[model samples]
Target: MADTAAEAEEKFIAEAKTRVSFVRQTGDALSRDTTVTQLVERMITHLRATVDDPDSPVRPQTIDRYENTVAILRGDYAGGKYPTIGDYPLSEVTEDLVHEWLWDVSVIGPSMGAQCRSAMLRAFDLAKDRGVRLWPVNPAKEAKLKRAPRHIARALTVEERERIIGNVTAWQTPRKRTDLLSIVRMLADTGMRPGEALALRWEDVDLTGAKATVTVSGTVVELKGKRADGKGIRRQPFGKSDAAYRTLTLSSEATTRLLERRVSASSYLVFPNDVGGVLSLRNIGTRWRKARGAEFDGVTLYDLRRTVATELDRKYGPAAAAAQLGHTSPAITGRHYIERATVVGDFTDALGTLR
Candidate 1:
């Protein structure tokens, strides 16, 4: 019986050693970059190194997002079967092929389509920087996005705004409802984008000065499913235009509304989530829809921004309005807002004067 037990133990030890050897062999194979697949593998190795480096700002979540995007791109090339990156030639990527790839997925929503294009663009950019002739030209730069149609900006009518605010005030759970109303009022008064509004921290707002400056400094945003993995977030100014980044003087009403909200003294976020983190744009949008009720159509959170801009144009001259809205040129303001009925009102009254 002792000899039989000893034989079984010896067999288990041998099998364990064999398994370890097999694992070691696989690791060794993955480590070498002898072919195109190896080069692709190298990209992942570089990404992982970047993600793991303590000094690097790239978060693990961001790295995961990039990895998933790369996996999708690679999987498409591997005949639907997962293969090592070394299996494919890096030189075969061309602008035409990328265009086709984008078109193939064009049925998806614009936001998602844009994200996929952006991901592929980043990969090609990395390859180009490394002196790899993978793509003839960056497809993202060359690919033509369909022009978005022009639509009239929807601002809340005076009656509608009153009704919505009244309804929100009467809600039993007025926490989110009140917050949305405040946000809408702020947007309508300040002409800030939904992203910019959500990104605002309490420190950024100077209540005494009644001025809010939106600079590209310290604004953290999750780009393409990427999250801030303990690395300090990158701050991007409101917009590229000098006017976009400038400080704006807030109205008394705006200042009053901000002060009314019970925010934590330690909480930096101006518009935080329930847990005092950054508010999700999706949640804000959903809540806004509910607040407006069934009668509201075509009105979006963005429309509050338009409303502010239009009001500014009416109160101030075109140039002043453009400056307030952070537009570099009056041309854009005119094209987007000034020409719209919501901004200019009915021109039919002017026709009678001409007659």
Candidate 2:
């Protein structure tokens, strides 16, 4: 069937090469020593590389959180005394080993354990999708974690809001107290996240008209690495979600506070720290703790935003509140932010008819 001996030889060599390639692939699959850590690292590298892409599935905050979870797995979190299985061979990892790791992390906090479990689940799936076939089954999928208790937010009363605003003992410095008051007021007025309020600049606000408007263009966050200027915390130039970027009408009180601060403002930030940098959330928490003393241990600065959401939901609707809070859906606002009403529609007449 061959045209010549040379042609026949060439066909034979081609078939032989195909068989060799198949054997090599099988051998590699059996002999590969890829570790769980390596797979996670690959996924993390990909995520970090494509995090800025508009089509990237994961958000920037998600990448940061995933990295933090990886730190835990590497025993590098905090003082490196945590649970670790980074060196375990991916093919050898069992469901029991994963369960043990999850339980160990749960000792720190159930919420933290849940977060780690979620990251691991995603990492394993991503790795598998990329043609990494080290594992027969995904160990992360088999792992189980106890459900963490959800924190239900209650709207602060008007009296509580006023007290938080007037608490002078919160900050020893008069300037800090004033800044805290303004920040609290802005959060209460607009239902904006604390980070959004902190990231605000003079350019984001327009007070020329009777009704002042504030643009929600960005948020303050602490990234993994320090920037060229040696600062870890900076404005992220975007909000948590697409809906977060919106323009809101400022209340008269918020407008007044901004105007007063603008007269003496030296920095571009609406709420700069003592060092004129973006006001860190840690500083805000400390001041809030000082102000609350022991009576309001459960109340947080975020509750102010929740309080605004509740008010808006009660006055207008969930849709309106969702818009004010920059939520993509009213369902999220209703389920998480707004407290459930104890009473609803009256069905007494219908019940009586049925009876």
Candidate 3:
């Protein structure tokens, strides 16, 4: 009886081990079967739900950039859709395939390709960290991409600035409006973003003190689904960054312009559309393009801000420019806005000693 009981016990233990092994194999298979598409969707959901900076909510531009990245990955960018490797199971995606795809996508735009690669890198890492390591290695970890081209800011010369101002003024003459001219002058004088300048309300400006000042409180942004056509635009009641919320002492010229506009202002906004509603940034850009035409090729409204930064950096220093531009770091102002050592101190005297 004792021998029979021992034999039965041993058989039961063997069966239990077999069941555990089967369960583990099933789990591994399930994890391996999770497709790239599935992971990307989950990753995007997480991005939409969470905020990295508690002080600042994610901006619409950030969401738009992610959407663009996904569009490229799914082969839905530009127009027609094509079957891509995004549908493949995580375990089946090879590093070489990712490398080649990244290189090919760079043809669209180096920055776009970089953004796509960044998203993929995060997706794969998130999966590997949280779920099972479906693959022995993260495929995106080793994938290489072409370096993006460096874009140096072009600061407008005084002559160019005058010509542009004249061009825009003449362009608006037929329309019998000075809205674009006001905005151009404001942008040139204050170094504020076009969106920030457009979002200004009468209450945000204080012209009563010894020095006039404008509060940088909010900015105009495009929204995805608040209109009948599934697109909306409105002012987000916060600046793009913490540094963006500043009280800027307006220049005398800017203050004078505002005083005049305030007297004739029809709406609460410092700048508004014909319908007394928030102006669409896209429309403003279109109008700007039409007004400037070939006469101001490659010159953009944002360049006016850059011109301010360059002039401020030259006159004072990078810190002043950063403060004016609402940048948190002087490094940012120096790197992107100020021209790179275009006017260095006369080093000839120092080098003369070597001679």
Model 3 gets an lDDT of: 0.77
Q: For residues 222-299, what per-residue lDDT tens digits would candidate 2 score against the true structure? A: 766767843478887889899999999987877888899899998889989866788878778787777765767878
**Better structure of 1 and 2 per TM-score:** 2
| Residue range 1-355, candidate 3, lDDT tens digits | 2379889899777756754553353333225777776666656655555534554345655665667666655768777332257677877878888878877776556776777777788778767655447667877777776776766988989999988888888788756443788888889989999999989999999999998999989899887666664348887778878898888899898899899989988898999987677888888888788777577887888899999999999899999999998999999888888876567778898899996
- The candidate 1 region of ten consecutive residues with least summed lDDT is 28-37
- How do these models rank on lDDT, best leading? 2, 3, 1
Q: Where in model 1 is the C-alpha error above 4 Å?
A: 1-88, 134-136, 147-151, 172-178, 209-228, 231-244, 259-268, 317-319, 327-355
Question: What TM-score would you give candidate 3 relative to the actual structure?
Answer: 0.79
Q: What is the C-alpha local distance difference test score of each model? A: 0.57, 0.78, 0.77
Residue 44, model 3, lDDT: 61
Model 2 regions more than 4 Å off: 1-32, 59-61, 76-82, 94-108, 134-144, 168-172, 175-178, 229-231, 343-355
CA RMSD of all predictions: 13.9, 7.3, 8.8
